[model samples]
Target: MEKKNALTAFAALSQPTRLDVFRLLVQVGEAGMSAGEIAAALDVRQNTLSANLSVLLHAGLVRNLREGRSIRYFADTEGLRGLLGYLLRDCCGGRPEICDPLIEDIACHARPTPLDKIGQYPTPEDHT
Candidate 1:
């Protein structure tokens, strides 16, 4: 991502509601969720959620797909990865150990999984 794009993404994520929406979309994976479903899950009003979603969409953090009558919003993982990489690219300029643990953790969790595989999520049933 370009520096300007990273700045835009960071600015979009700076808002509380937008941050929650973005994180929720990330958790939802590539399948994503509809506007109504997201609003219900977050207990946010329709117009409010719509505005926040727009900002995130503009920031390139989320993408919307028209699925029949409903639009599904999914996280732009590539853009997010780029932003994270850009931020950490200059880390540990001299002392490699400064970021070794983080690199190890990322490597440990880097095993790829097919998007169709739905891991355990805290569904409504799980809440109770």
Candidate 2:
């Protein structure tokens, strides 16, 4: 990601509601959630959530799909990867080991399941 794009994403996440929305979307993975569902989950008003969602969309941190009358929102994984890559581009100078643990902690270890092919970590229920 370019510097400006990263800055926008950071700024969007700096807000409490937007941050909560993004984290919640990430947790839900590809299944995504409708606006109503998101509003209910976050206890945010529909109008307020709409504004926050728009900010996240503009920052490339979140995406939405039109599902008939409602819109379903999801974390934009590609955008997220770009932002993460930009941050780690010069990670730990020349000491690769310094960033190893952090990388390991964030990286997924499980194979992708049919229901979640985007490298989201499998939930325990997935094994059932």
Candidate 3:
């Protein structure tokens, strides 16, 4: 992602409601949720949720799909990966030990699944 886009994403997540919504979506994963579902989950008003969702969509943090009368929103993993990669691209001047712990933390934060069950996440030993 471009530096400007990353800044926009960070700014969008800075708000309480938007941050909650984004985290909620991330937790929900690819199954996603409709506007109504998201509103009910967060106890946010439709109008307010719409505005926040719009900002997330613009920042490329969230994506929506039209499903009949409803729109299902998903966490834009690609965009998020790009943002994370940009931040960690040059970690501790290429020292894995300094960066491995941080990477582990990020992986944990990105998914709700157990590390053992989620084989996709790399263990510290994998990098060593």
| Candidate achieving the largest TM-score | 2
**10 residues in a row with least lDDT, candidate 3:** 119-128
- RMSD to native for every prediction? 7.8, 7.4, 8.7
Global Cα lDDT for candidate 1: 0.80
Question: What would the per-residue lDDT of candidate 3 be over residues 13-77, giving only the tens digit for each residue?
Answer: 99999999999988877678899999999999999999999999889888887777787888888
* TM-scores for every candidate against the unseen true structure: 0.77, 0.83, 0.81
Candidate 1 weakest ten by summed lDDT: 119-128
Q: Report the error of model 2 at residue 106, Å.
A: 1.8
Per-residue lDDT over 27-91 for candidate 2, one digit per residue giving the tens place of the 0 to 100 score: 88888888899999999999999999989998988887777778888888888999999888988
Best by lDDT: 2
lDDT of candidate 3 at residue 79, scale 0 to 100: 78
| Candidate closer to the true structure by lDDT (higher is better), 2 or 3 | 2
Cα RMSD of predicted structure 3 = 8.7
Please report, in order, the local distance difference test score of every candidate based on alpha carbons. Answer: 0.80, 0.85, 0.81
Ranking by lDDT: 2, 3, 1
Regions of model 1 farther than 4 Å from truth: 105-128
